[model samples]
Target: MKPTITITYCPKCGWLLRSSYMATELLTTFADELNGVLLKPAETAGEFCISIDGEPLVDRKAAGGFPEITALKRLVRDRVAPDKSLGHSDRVHAKPDSGKDEK
Candidate 1:
């Protein structure tokens, strides 16, 4: 079964918009890989967490802040579609070492 992503955010903290935006990005990027994205209103104050199948993937308080959209997409993609390419959302790696003497 495809994984479902849950974005649990504190409505009291006005995180609904943030959570919804993340949901949108995840849905767009992993349309085929995900079952669906759930936007949940957190009961606890200042709570913001992303979960997959009830397993916590990220916690805003623990992480010190929210993750950027690209980071969040990468996290979801890694779990739902390990081999999937995220195109511009992907990280840029350092150039490969070239076996040539420095001039």
Candidate 2:
């Protein structure tokens, strides 16, 4: 069974747009893997979280910050489509060790 993704955002914190954006992005990105994406208004103030089938994926309070878009996608992709590629998101972001090459 495909997993249902849920984003709970704090209205007081003005995170509704953020939640909506994630829902849209996830829907488009994981159309083949996800069952549905739900945007829920959080009861607690300043609370924003993402869960898949009730399993916490992004716990803002616990993490002390929101998850980066790539990290969040990685988490979901790992659960839903482990074999799927996330294009640029899946690619490692790095630069060569310039000083080491210079001797």
The runs of at least 3 residues in candidate 1 whose Cα sits more than 4 Å from the true structure, single-residue gaps closed, are: 93-103
For model 2, which pairs clash?
Answer: none
lDDT of 1 at 39: 95
Q: Give a tens-digit lDDT track for model 1, residues 1-103.
A: 9888899999998989999888888888888888999999988999999999999999999999999998888888788888999998886778988988898
Q: How close is candidate 1 to the true structure, as a TM-score?
A: 0.87
Q: Which 10 successive residues of model 2 have the least lDDT summed?
A: 94-103
In the range 6-100, model 2's lDDT, one tens digit per residue, is 99999999998888888888999999899999999988999999999999889999999988888889999998899999999998878967766
Q: After superposition, how far is residue 64 of candidate 2 from its true place, in Å?
A: 1.8
Model 2 residue runs over 4 Å out of place are 96-98, 101-103
Model 1 residue 5 CA deviation in Å: 0.6
The local distance difference test score of each candidate is 0.90, 0.91
Compute each candidate's TM-score over C-alphas.
Answer: 0.87, 0.91
